[model samples]
Target: MTDEIKVPDAGTADKAKLTVAILVVIAGVAGYYVLAGRPAWLRWTPVAGSLALAALVLAFSRYGREFRQFVELARVELRKIVWPNRQETGMTTLVVFIFVVVAGIFFWLLDLGLAWATKLITGQGS
Candidate 1:
């Protein structure tokens, strides 16, 4: 029989990430206290440590492959996104303005017609 080792489960990965997050937060707070007004290198210690912790958490997850795949899919979808060009956007705006103007004219005409009809029926117009 062939033998193959199963990778860590999703729960394990999630737990690892949680633990890493807690450690990062603690480390960041400690670093701030140790070097509150220190130089760039001292300040960067915690910042870089947090980033490294995030990397380790992600790396330790069982769903790491799936997560990476989803990120890749998102990137591909972004590439396929079709942004409207300036000319097309301008044309659409112009069309909307024209439609609004035309609609206003139509409503105004309708209102005037109704008013005239009412006036005629009541003998208000000579």
Candidate 2:
């Protein structure tokens, strides 16, 4: 048995769809600004409409399919994760905070020691 790879041909239609999708998103932003004088409800209509249309267009493209698959896989992986409990999370955060404080103190002391040494070497310290 031979291992064969099948790549989907991105034809003109897919490219057109992707272009239309991008244009729809741009139009949505422009439309939102254009409808600024209108009421809030009316102003948001074109933006929402354009976004939906763009999403629809993209859904038909190869990239969109791959994105959806990735999302699905991510969701599955996330579900499989053994999440830490609230107590464990709190403890981890506390540990990080303590380490940060200790490191800050160490760095501050090192800086002070260096400053003192520099002044002594330059004969500038009283």
Candidate 3:
């Protein structure tokens, strides 16, 4: 039998907290727009404060914990990547450019041949 992982359902409180967190962020954006006539600093303050509080609330939820773990895993995997150097990148780019040029020339010749054949058959053009 294959092992399957089942995610547990979030508790009621966790769901409520997540909802509140989302609402807090939405309220922050709305407040920012609503305070457009006020000073820039004052307009931004609600957005900044509400976002911080939302983040705090989300951090206490199970989904947030899972998200943090996923981010950590992604960071670890990113470190294992072997990025190509400048010379290799340049050579690859040059090869692709050459291939594209050759392909374009080949297609152009094919199109000219087809047009000549069609004109000869239909007697339409010199």
Candidate 4:
């Protein structure tokens, strides 16, 4: 088997639906800016309406249904996780902080040694 990610192609109708959904959102944004002098609710009408319309249009698309299924599956998987307790979390955080400080010190010493070597070889530190 090849190590390639394979994505299924949505058919022509689904592609058209997705395109219309995108255009609806773009038009809504443009309308919002174009109606900037209007009242807040009036300006927001197109934004809200377009989002709802876009979502409605997207519901008919194949990938949209797949996304819904993915979200549902994710929720099921999310519930199976055993999260770390507060004490375990604190210990892990402390270990990470200690390693970071040690790494920083090691890098700083390496840099200083390299700088000293370069200056000595070139006699440019004066």
lDDT of 1 at 113: 100
Per-model lDDT = 0.82, 0.93, 0.95, 0.95
Using lDDT as the yardstick, the better of models 2 and 3 is 3
Measured on C-alpha atoms, candidate 4 has an lDDT of 0.95
What candidate 2 gets wrong by more than 4 Å, as runs, is: 1-6, 26-49
TM-score of 4: 0.70
lDDT over C-alpha atoms for residue 37 of model 1: 79
Error at 69, model 1, angstroms: 2.3
Weakest lDDT window of 10 consecutive positions for candidate 3:
58-67
Clashing pairs in 3: none
Question: What is the Å distance of residue 69 in model 2 from its true position?
Answer: 1.5
Q: How would you encode candidate 1's per-residue C-alpha lDDT over 1-126 as one tens digit per residue?
A: 999998755576587676777788678767867887799788878878886776667665655566788899999999999999999999999999999999999999999999999999999997
Name the lDDT value of residue 70 in candidate 4.
Answer: 94
Cand. 3 TM to true fold: 0.67
Q: Which ten residues in a row have the lowest lDDT in candidate 4?
A: 58-67
Candidate 1: C-alpha RMSD to true structure equals 9.6
Cα deviation of 44 in candidate 3 (Å)?
8.6
lDDT of 3 by residue, 5-117 (tens): 99799999999999999999999999999998999999999999999999999898998898899999999999999999999999999999999999999999999999999
Q: What TM-score goes with each of the models? A: 0.49, 0.72, 0.67, 0.70
